[model samples]
Target: MQGFTIIEIMIGLAIGLLTLLAIYKLFATSEGRRRTTAAVSQAQTAGALALFAIERDIRSAGLGFAGMDPAYLGCAVQAYKRTGRDPAQYSFPLMPVQIVNGSELRVLTGSSTNMFIGARYSASASGVFTMERSNAGFQAGDVVVGTSDTDPGNCLLMEVTAGAGSDITGPGGVAEDDPTVRHLSSGYTSFYTGASVTPERNGGSSVDMLDGGATSLGEGWLFSLGNRPTRNVWRVQDNQLMRYNFLDETDTKSVGVAEDVLQMVAEYGFDKDGSGKIDKDNEWTGVDAELVASKLDRLMAVRVAILVRSSQYERDAVTSAAPKWANGSKDFVMGSGDDWPHYRYRVYESVIPLRNTIWGQQQ
Candidate 1:
């Protein structure tokens, strides 16, 4: 039998090793391409889904509730939750005429958000508020905001904690969420005739109490804010788009809607002179100057941008430069912890008109 030379055996081994190395390289390249494509597709879907959700809500902003009238824009709301984790959650000046990322989008959403105030709600009383009739049109746990006939700017929010007749109490007045405390110890049935209410006294450029007593809220109109007002707030956290129903009155945390989201940017489109149109170049702004209560009425539309990042990692840099749009109005930014160039990004943008408020202006 003839034996093969050691040189021939060595050459055969080397050729086999080279072929295996080539196969491995091809596999790695194919796998990398597949992952990048999947990641890009996922980021695209997330951006679109998030944009659609936000757009739908912004387009339906306030519906017949807060967006029905321009006067209600930036309306001051004082809310109290029964089982709320934070005391400062429900009280603030809502509807600043624009919505943005890292910020909140608050809109009143429900079936019927209107009613008539029956009597004067003496600030001195608690546990009960009366409507035009004894019927409790407002069910228990319904969140209601009462507007003062004397001052529409001054509003009080309360949750019904009692049975039929829809009684309300000050904060801590109920076993749970009674905001009108007087309603808790309110003795009389049907309607509690508490101590006489004093009118608001002013001058000295300050709001004063008459007769050195708590000023009464002259009940004018009652707006049912629903059981736990839907004060929807949008946020971004942990590479996800988060939504916190700030007024749900529960200890529930914010829910995530989209994945791989980096950040969001939003701007305002104003009518300026109530032209029933938006002056994009002259009046579109993201600054706080337009955040004032007086400037809110001029708000016509909102421009929003949502950036989403691909989750796949590449060995080489994918993005060579920073991203910007609309003449650098929205500059793309990422946290320092990111290896940005190794990832891809997608931007979803739109200009949503404040249709409800805009219609109100046309009238």
Candidate 2:
């Protein structure tokens, strides 16, 4: 065979090598860009979805049961159990917009049409609360909240243990003091003795009780009794945004609102003057049950900040540094350990108004 020069063969090999190198570079560049884009998109989508649910519930906060007057939507009470894997998971219950320690949020929702309407509930000195409503739909083990729109400070929440029809009893009072004729201990039955009931108390509705010996729910208090008292809670847990429904007493199931959510922080605005407008000077850097109960009526707005990260590796391995969120002097850092190079981050934030409470102000 005709032999080629050594230089010619070498040149040909070099050209082939160059072409292969170019292809590799192109692939690497494209993959880097793709990962970056995907990370950004994921963060954006997660942020939007989380904010939507929060805003929706925040706007609906303090909403009363259907067919009920809007005037009743007020911050009535703050009560919640603080026992869980995460302390933030449980905080005080505020009727409308309840910010717990400026990190967690709880909103209450309900409809008046489902349960007993216009039913009156009273708490005896012994802590027994009785409800009397014709055709009352309350059942044993049902969670209920007593609220007075005009009197936000006075509210009662409890679990019904007896009665369903015209009479209902709560988890309080001595066993002997219970209405014996109605509660045979074997089962719940409706028995309305309007005449036999003490004149100081109206025996028309069923009676229930809450522990702690606090007579918060007084006679003539408006009733929003229902088996379903929708209490929505939102917080960041284990790098994700989570929601817990207090209404579902049994499950206490937590649903993931968004993934890769790193942190959630908030600021509250108050309408200290009843002017129907939020005042900046009245802003609360943080809030909790005490603040909610003491200043709930004055709260007018809330601003929340959420931080999220990418679910997959999106950065070049050469740089192990995690992404940082620059918010002026305060920079939020995201990512850690071996996967730090694999992710990017973004922040989603919004300032939402408490429309229900604001609307109540206009009236």
For residue 78, model 2's alpha carbon misses the true position, in angstroms, by: 10
Lowest-lDDT window of 10 residues in candidate 1?
Answer: 201-210
> What lDDT does the true structure give each of the candidates?
0.58, 0.55
Off by over 4 Å in 1: 67-72, 88-90, 96-104, 111-142, 160-219, 249-252, 326-329, 335-338
How much is the lDDT of residue 267 in candidate 2?
A: 67
Worst 10 residues of 2 by lDDT: 197-206
| lDDT tens per residue, model 1, 74-148 | 657665543434553345564633454324455444443443222234332233444443434454444455555
Name the lDDT value of residue 201 in candidate 2.
Answer: 14
| Candidate 2 TM-score versus the reference | 0.64
Residue range 89-173, candidate 2, lDDT tens digits: 2324445666776678877765434423345554333434454433155444344455543354444454444434333345674
The Cα error of candidate 1 at residue 160, in Å, is 6.1
TM-score per candidate, in order? 0.72, 0.64
